[model samples]
Target chain A: MKKNHSGVRIGEVTLKWFIALHLSLIVNSLAGVASKMAGKQKFLSFRFCICYGMVLVITFAFALAWQQVLKHMSLTFAFTNKPITIIWGLIWGVLVFHEHVTWKMILGSAVILLGIMVGVSGDSGSDGSSLPPEGGKGDV
Target chain B: MFEGLGRYIAVWIVSVFISSIAQVMLKMEANREHASKLKEYMNPMVVSAYFIFFLSTFLTMYALKYVPLTYSPIIEPMSYIFVPVIGVLLLKEKISRRRLIGMGIMIAGIVIFSM
Candidate 1:
């Protein structure tokens, strides 16, 4: 019984870590996209080139970290938790873009958040356990 | 003004959906293709070089043109959020009661978070 409970706890922790890693991906991707859209064309300015390079480097680093994380976690859990970035994006939009938040948008985000929580909570099996082998081909 | 906002939103949605499909298809293709050629695929030196070239040449260009950088990443998460909905509609997958409840709670949380 104790072993079973511990296993469940470990799974929950893994899910939370997966969510955080995905959040990093979303935030970093947004930053990269914003930089590019700001007219930081390639080879235009030395500083812009440096910034773009840095973004690429950091994104690659995060991709590596994510590959490591996936080794111990289920893809379903990881992928399901990834959608929380939509909620984060909404937050960023309000703060950065000064977009108005409508009730409908709010409701939609709530449904997504609730769905992720419940999805993670209900899973207790070893389905989707076939993780891609470690140090395999990875992407950013 | 109404039409303008609607257009923007529609374009955003369509672009994101296409990109999502692209991502999934790429992953699926890469996995299936590489499994048979594991020796070549697992060659990290080659894969890293390929990834860098692919991102800079293909993925980045399409992404920047169709979707604003700032918003694209945020919207990328929608792929996951909508997967179940897609499964239900297109694949005829069943949603259990627990999943329904979870979906409801997620909707509520998203509302609060957005505000």
Candidate 2:
């Protein structure tokens, strides 16, 4: 039946997004390795090494958490929410690192949020009929 | 010491390869099942990503044996930012004005985040 086919198609798309979320984490890990190695070789300066190392630790933790999240959430929900890390980074910058949070920072966060909203709205509208009626995709 | 550099570079490349495989696996796994189907989660890609995921973790630990972590995360996100650019260029994906604005904001955030 058409309904069954649509259900299968929806499932397929949902799976793709899940893979994308996981791939994002994997790519992030690889980048961490590359940067660390670059710093060790002095291809990047010493100052860069310290900064890069902190990022590696943070991202590693995040990537691990993301793996667990992927086990439970839809890819679309998970990935669209990933950028919220910027908000956390902003908090870390202000609270821990004592960095400034300029108007630009606020503006950037707002724009990113807006874009995510728009994208999510578009996606949901297009796939409205295909998605499961209850529970739908799990939260990220 | 120079030999050590070569060794690290070799390890890094291997890590990249493994990480790429993990990415592909994760992608394939995501495509096959809804997140709600947690009970029925058996896919070759999921298995591969997990295997490589751990391998990358070890490789990362070894890498940290020589390199510092500070610079790693800064550069790490570069791929995430860059891959989309490649998609835009190679796949001919349209970059909407809103998305472009969003990317610009993200770039600025990255600079600030780096600082």
Candidate 3:
């Protein structure tokens, strides 16, 4: 049980890593957008392939950025913070798909976000938030 | 509900649930020792987990046809609730009070979002 505290303040150690995490999440949610576009196309069709291919591309980019973020931050913090993508997802829905956003939906998302924050707050008792030992292998 | 896209919605939720199971399966497999690094991921458990993930990705694409991107994110968070419950039921893991509250709040959100 160790708290690898370099004493700079936890959670988003640097603005650079914070940007990296948010960027990865933003790009990753676009994979859902591409998948949705793929769904609209006929299966095995060229358009479907193109859209799904875009999903793969976006996911690959996200994976690279995510690795950098994980190298800096903790997985528990990263996972719990992923709901930010929901906001991006909502924006993409309205902008790309012309989907309607109602007050109920906003309220519901708010509650979920609040609940997740509560859960994260409670997760601090253990050393679960720390990264694995430096140079630990099998990163794949 | 969902303008009779119930079947696709069902498929999407099931895929999410299955993928979370795959995560657990991978964790369980990783906890075990393997003769070699290649054998670690090449073994039946890990291979099956990846296969499940692959199939679920396709299922997600299929389900996205009827499920709008807007509602998809709302529903997708359900996996946050799924993983811990699976851990408790299968691995006999204990739950913390905050997580239970979090799940309860998320359930409330889901019900509200659905209605």
Clashing residue pairs, backbone N/CA/C < 3 A, model 3:
none
TM-score (C-alpha, index-matched) for candidate 3? 0.86
Residue by residue across B1-115, what tens digits does model 3's lDDT show?
6457788888888887887777667766766888998999899887887787778778888888988778865567766676667767776766788878887887787777777
lDDT tens digits, residue span B1-115, model 1: 4275345444445544544333433343444434456654565544554454444333343344433333432244344345445545644645666666765665565455445
Runs off by more than 4 Å, candidate 2: A1-57, A124-140, B1-85, B93-115
Please name the candidate that would achieve the greatest TM-score relative to the true structure.
3
lDDT of 2 at B43: 55
Docking class of 1: acceptable
Candidate achieving higher TM-score, 1 or 2: 1
For model 1, how does the per-residue alpha-carbon lDDT over A1-140 read when each residue is reduced to its tens digit? 12353353344454346456676556444543443433335554676566555655655665676676666666655545554545655666566555566666666665665566565446443543121111111111
Per-candidate interface C-alpha RMSD?
6.8, 8.7, 5.5
Q: Measure candidate 1: CA RMSD.
A: 7.4
Estimated TM-score per prediction? 0.52, 0.38, 0.86
In the range A1-140, model 2's lDDT, one tens digit per residue, is: 12353243233345444455555544443444343343444434675565456545645655565666656566445545554433443454455435456665556555544444344333332322211111100011
lDDT digits (tens) for residues B40-106 of candidate 2 = 3555556665666556645654655553333232323333333334445544534455445555654
Q: What order do you get sorting by DockQ, best first?
A: 3, 1, 2
Q: Could you give the CAPRI-style class of model 3?
A: acceptable
